[model samples]
Target: MFSPALLQMILVAALLSLLSAGKLTASDYYVATTGNDQNPGTLNQPFRTVARGISSARQPGDNVIVRKGIYPQARTLNLANPGTADNYISLKAFEEEEVIIDGSNLQKDATLIAVLSHHIRIQGLTVRNSQNIGISIWGPGTRVHAVEVSGNRVHHCQNSGIYAGFNRLHDPVRDLLIEDNVISECSLMNEGGRYNQWSFGAGAGLSRKVTIRNNTVSHCYGEGIGLYLSNKGTIEGNTVHDNFSVNIYLDNTTNTRVSRNLVYSTEDQRFYRFNHPASGIQIANENYQGFNNPSSHNVITNNILIGNYIAISSGSYQRGGGLKHTLIANNTAWGSIGPLLHIDADTSHYKSRISNNIFKQTGNVPLTDIQGSTARIEFSNNLWHGGVPQQSARSTSDLEADPQLINGGSFNPEAYRLSESSPAHNAGIKLPEVEQDFNGKPRSKNFDIGAW
Candidate 1:
């Protein structure tokens, strides 16, 4: 004898099941030669192509772990579906091998690889040789977290190797972690098309709230780490070398910290058949007339800037310069084409604390610190390694004596032991340290010489 209450409970249970079934389920997909698309996408019965596997995956917590092989897609592998809060979709490599997603689409002129969906995680895959951007994230106002792109290689892409931001100007992609990925062999070009007519090569747009750490980025056509409207992000522990353009470019950003990154350019591997040099750590203002979107509240500290055109350049144009409140300290820049410190700001509102850095130039025109009427460019405790200083009638105060390094004008980590006779041994300002020691150790004594 079933009671009325029992019947009501059964009805509620059935309704709950219906609602739960509508949500995306946790399913796995494999990719191998001997696989089955018809069967359930399990380890044994894997799908052939990445597009097929990704399409069949349900939303929220649905994951596709591509095994070791080359997977080709007709168009971009679009992960634009909205995932639930609990169930986030993940596309990752099975064993961190050469899991290649070959995006050599000959039919299309340029493929815009956009990850427009929500709560997506992609890790450990080599995305290479695309006509457009290699791996991009266009998630608007969505939390994209724990995207571990480690131990993979990206090369010979036309556009940027890694891009994380929304397509729109205001909204930005947030909470991305790009670590230990080797990005090289990319060519930068000004392809006139849908891609914001003002786009440069590899490093040419806005990235936000992301951490680009410990990766070796080199041999690109544009900047090393391009902060286009990117803010509150930390870029450290990375080696950016051998790019055609600027190394670390900050445009229309604020509250970002770029510390301890080794930025320089070697003889370019020649992605394109051209011959031109580049700069290192170039910062400039964007939107000259319309928007006063200057990259404000940024800190450049403890970096090793070596062998480039210009070590660091502040402000965009010669007259239109008033980008203010930047901190440049404890950096060691050697063998540059232009001045070690070139500030083209117009006003004293361009306040900066330039302290305890080693500026060594092989060329004649050395440190050029342009002091405007309103600009208070505090020069304190900086060790002039070599070259004649740029003598200006404007006040450049507290310039320190030479803190001779053991190995003059050359960087060798093995012989980089701080000599007791060196003035730079303990000559750093006692500010809050942004980065740690070489082997991820704690840096307690104020700060180190350069980015460890």
Candidate 2:
């Protein structure tokens, strides 16, 4: 005989199973290659246009599924609706399907997808071959928040691959996530979009709490990744290469963290003719307008820079232009030119901390401090080799020893790491940010000089 308590427990388990399996209340609308826009958005008889599917999603828990095909729309797909915290409007490719949103026929300056609202997710699609940005999100008239752009292939765009929050008179975007996207071949070739200066591969201007992670950005005529005035953001685990101006640029940003990213340079010789040098990372305050916000409280750590003209630059030359309280640590810089590390400013209050970094130059004057005529710089525990050899700034801990790395005289990615027998090992100043090496290996308690 079964006990009454045991039967009650069995009945409760069965009721919970029914509620968990049948709890889905959201609808899934489909868009296909062979369907008409006049059809109801069902699985078999779906809508043809992506815009039609978006219009038919009546609630926040609705999803718009696009099938595998070439969507050759020439106009912008504007997402103007908002979703709640529990539910978001998702526009994505069908399961394991290859959906290509080809914007080859779009007019110049016409963006492909513009998300003007919050709680939207765009993923697993190919958005490419456009005249302007592949995807953009902004609330020009008001504030927008919580956007996720991931797992997409954006390429061959004439301007930026993915741009955010660069409009005029707009409230800054908050809580943005851009990750695992392959963005390349954004040719900013002076087509009236960027006449004076070119666009970026992926970037945001006037945003906060943004995260850019694990993306591959290459072959850009402008900077690879630029965050202008984007505060409290993090750039991590991205590979940025083959850019014209600088691989990564932070202009007038505050409280930003850049870490574990690989930045290298490529020569096209076009920038040389225009009197521009290929730089790796630059933090400046030259482009601010009425808002004269300083670049402060930013940290750059555990990066690998190879084959660049300048490894990293800080501060500025104009009046009231400089960085304050920035930290640069645990990076490997190999094969650069023209003062591989330069910090120049016209003010005395420019302050920066450079530590535990490896600077191996291609015979360039690796550094010029102040150019410290007046700036406050704290540089220490770094390894320097083979530059034009400028007089280094004063530091408590300095090492001119040869960093015994593998292929130590070349531009290989592993060339700047410390060998077991290297003098740089266990000879660096201990910094809080130097907890890891370039490969994310934990540093020793005694510390190893330079980025491993």
By TM-score, the best candidate is: 2
| Cα TM-score of candidate 1 | 0.85
Question: Lowest summed-lDDT stretch of 10 residues in model 1?
Answer: 191-200
| Clash count in backbone of candidate 1 | 8
lDDT of 2: 0.77
Which runs in model 2 stand beyond 4 Å of their true positions?
Answer: 1-24, 140-142, 166-170, 187-197, 270-277, 315-320, 348-351, 364-375, 392-396, 408-415
Candidate RMSDs in Å, in order, are 3.9, 7.0
* Pairs of residues clashing in candidate 2: 369-372
> What would the per-residue lDDT of candidate 1 be over residues 26-49, giving only the tens digit for each residue?
777777655767766788788877
